[model samples]
Target: MNIDSITNGVVIDHITAGAGMRLYELLGLGELDCSVAIIKNVQSAKMGKKDIIKIDALIPIDFDVIGYVDPGATVNIIRDEKLVEKRTIDMPELLTGVIKCKNPRCITSVEQELDHVFRLTDRAGKVYRCIYCETKAG
Candidate 1:
């Protein structure tokens, strides 16, 4: 309940409830040496229930990964214990290497070196189709 603030780091806020761990795993936060905290199911006036991730270091983050996981989330950059920048995430128009195409016959399956690419085809439905085979991304 008592989480300390970071002096210089990034905070991922307004995460959809129960999505903090998925974001953490996809972002590979566990591999970092800095302190990281994941707060789950925090009551929020706006979101009802949300999650937050605080990283105690300034590290490069792949926004595409965050968008893919939860586009409704926000990113806060803290410097000298003050918020320097606040970013509202949106669904990326294109995603590369963020998600693998589940289609077995896709080119990515045959060519291991090919990066899995998906383009957002339907923003309303949150649909992403593989660029190689036009297969819907799962």
Candidate 2:
């Protein structure tokens, strides 16, 4: 599907192919209930299979999701169909309440629906370690 562009809001680009839906959930976009355009399995020169999410409302980004998924993804804020804030997602120093720490022995598992916390161990390596159990994930 070809879209001209969103009149307002933000365009999240360079998303990992399958991670598009997860990104939406991780950021709680479902709760916002806004008009969102999710383009999956799009051809990309840089990334073999990429995705683009265009939200129709002006919503503040949840950077934690970006840090967990593709730290290199770019967030382009659009206003009146004009490029405004173009930011490349950077690996966060610490990640909390974002991704679930994959440690069974970790305290997060003991508590139900506990906010998962992690740390970006290697920015260059795209590695993350659980803050609770200190387990390396993704």
TM-score of each: 0.96, 0.84
Global lDDT of each candidate: 0.94, 0.83
* Residues 7-53 of candidate 1: C-alpha lDDT, one tens digit per residue: 99999999999999999998999999999999999999999999999
Q: How many pairs of residues collide in each model?
A: 0, 0
Candidate 2 lDDT, 5-36, residue by residue in tens = 78889899999898899888788888877788
TM-score for candidate 1, residues paired by index? 0.96
The Cα error of candidate 1 at residue 62, in Å, is 0.9
Worst 10 residues of 1 by lDDT: 98-107
Those runs of model 1 whose alpha carbons end farther than 4 Å from true positions after fitting are none
Candidate 2 wrong stretches, greater than 4 Å? 111-115
